[model samples]
Target: MNETRREYIKRINIVLDFIENNLDTKLSLEYLSKKAHYSAYHFHRVFLTLVNESLNEYVNRKRIERIAAILLVKPNSSLKNLAYKYGFNSDNSFSRAFKKYYGISPTKFKSEGKELLSKIGIEPFSSEKYICSIDNIKQWTKMNAQITIKELPELKLASISNIGNFEKAGSMFQKLMEWGHQKRVLDTSNFKAITIYRDNPNITQTSKVRFSACVTISENINTDGEINQHNLKKGIYSIGHFEIKAEEISKAWKSMSIWVIENGYEFRDGDYFEMYHNDHKTHPEQKFIIDICIPLQKTENIKLGEINNLDLSKYKDNLDYHQLISYMKELRLFFQKEYDTIFKLGKIYQGAPNFSYFSLTTDELKKQKLKFVIILNHKELYFSICLSGQNKSIRKKYWKIFKGSDWNKYHLAESIDNSLSIIDQTILKNPDFNNKRNLTERIEKESLKFINDIKNILE
Candidate 1:
């Protein structure tokens, strides 16, 4: 695509993100045009041409879709409240819009929840999928990319934004690298090429999608012309790593989304982007090794069924250190298996034999890590999750922010002198170590909760 088209995609994408994030608020042509850096008349004409919908129509349709998704999840939720939440002025107006968009009243759509989604061509994913035999999802993701959750650190980036084909990202990356090398800031060891996606392909035309090609930069840099600074906040991300030909990128993303929904995660409103890990030319098949990062949140009010058939009949009260060591290895292996099953791949930390914890990096840029630990002492078992191994100075910088935040849902780590390490509800006490099945279940459930709680604070 041409440079002009790229700029248009970049700007319109910013507007698209603004609209999605502020769905409950009133949006005006004047404000949106300002955001796009275009005259109101020109912005209106361009938006209609590129998006194939007038500003009002596009916003209203998105609002209606949001309501439909929510109504299906919360059937008893007040319709008037839901309408008002999505910017409807009155019940009559919301009802009219709902019918026009979905060909049914809000009340009727709620009653026929999954049916409503089918009629509107919306993919249906409910809490039931979370409980269904994991066979389908396991098969779906098995041959595809593996998915894992990690905490990303805040990044200082030098970026060039453009609208158009994603293939144009190469030019942007090249520009940043050239500039960085001239300024003596492009260190090969730590260099990273990333793309910040601004629009949803499902919602916006592919030709009009906006992307910001960015490279990690040293702290505080000056820029001129179209080069801009974007600070990416630290948070938890569901990362899908793929090594595939360019044509298969869309399938990789679809697999990532499917994994999230099937596993009962709600899409968090944030940037969706890709991080390129290797040069495509190096691969024999010319496949790109990229990590597709999507922000995610575990669904609220989800009730999981108990594994009643779990057998915990075997009990051994006493064992030699050799036997104890064998059990610890089994424990580590169990967690590794579970983590691999859910996250695709992760770095497991078994630093100490008595207490081995899996460490997930909070931010690769800052070298920070979150630790999930399992401790066993004969008849007793304990699980602890916390943040640790962060640079002390960096922890000092974020200490006030952590201190000012809520800690009701998490346990502050007891051993770490620095305040960065956090424990999850403290060590679980007296878990049935003899019952491996039940113990694994608790570890699986609690570990996820730990990850989620820490994400809330970091994000």
Candidate 2:
């Protein structure tokens, strides 16, 4: 891509984002040209060349499709309100435009939109209909996937934005991998190829829906022309790990969506993506191994985003988190088997993809309503332990005591109102995992020291 083309794509991307987000408002060539810093006529030509559609044509299609989506969800929803809300002048005008796209009037579309959508080769995801047939979805998911709720860590990514033509993604990923190898910033220990959906295909016109092909980066690399750099938000998600044929990808996503709704989880507005594992081309039956991740609202009592206690940057590394998780499981078993009499160890909690931990409490500490947590933060590639109470009130009481005291032996919480730990200590950083036994011995020494020191303080 040349400099002029790059600038054109970048500017057009901004305008597209704005137009998609604000379709209910007046969008004129002059107003949109201002957004692109181009003259109205020049912007018109640029949009036509890049998008292969006139600005008005693109806008009108989007509005009509959005109305189509609404009708699918609410067959009785007022077409006049929806059509006018999306910038149509009147009922007759909206009908003409809607018919141009769907080949049927808006009123007819409200009744037969699903069939119309299927004819256009677009799969519809209707929330209203999905709710009615959730039991089958649940059964399908149970037979095909192992689903769980997880908190994914913030990830640094280099991505290429693509519109509609998803078949081109394979080539896009190839280009990205080549670029990553050239930069020497690929996390080779743990490789991740992600496809992020920027627009809901069910609501937006399939040809206009945007998706991005992304790869994980070990450093904060600068964006190159069409490739951009950004971070995936850290949040709660409903993750479904599946190994399915290429054709079943859409079914996997829809099933996951229905499962999230059926489980009482409110969807959070964020990235809905697929983290691909194996290339379908290499599979015997051409199957893609993937994890479908859907962002979700935090459960009550677990205050997400309220506490920024984890100094995430302090432990950033190129370590493969999945590999680190395997190590964590091994280490947990070592403690359980070797010190069974000395420690009552809890199972490793993997609710989050970026970190995992197990609880450790002695008989004496159990009476005190306290335990210690050994956490492996794969984002930082380090291990740390914290003192936590059995409940929120207990943790709060201990946190206040530490906050008031002059004990600087470890990192204390600034506030406990939303934090999980009272005080924490970093026991190890960037472990040399090649020699597993040596690494385990080192961790054992440091962890025991932190535990004894904290115990002495309390006693």
Taking the candidates one at a time, how many backbone clashes does each contain? Answer: 6, 2
Q: Report the C-alpha lDDT of model 2 over 286-373, residue by residue, as the tens digit.
A: 6687989988878773343321212344443444545677889999999998889999997776544456788899999999899999
What would the TM-score be for candidate 2 when compared with the true structure?
A: 0.58
Best by lDDT: 2
> lDDT (CA) for every model shown?
0.64, 0.79
Candidate 1 residue pairs in backbone clash: 6-162, 6-163, 9-163, 147-343, 151-362, 153-363
Q: Write the per-residue lDDT of candidate 1 for residues 287-343, one digit (tens) a residue.
A: 787888887654453223211111222224543334555655666677666565433
TM-score of each: 0.50, 0.58
Candidate 1, which segments miss by more than 4 Å at Cα? 1-17, 33-54, 61-79, 95-134, 160-164, 175-189, 202-211, 219-228, 264-266, 298-459
lDDT at 321 for candidate 2? 44
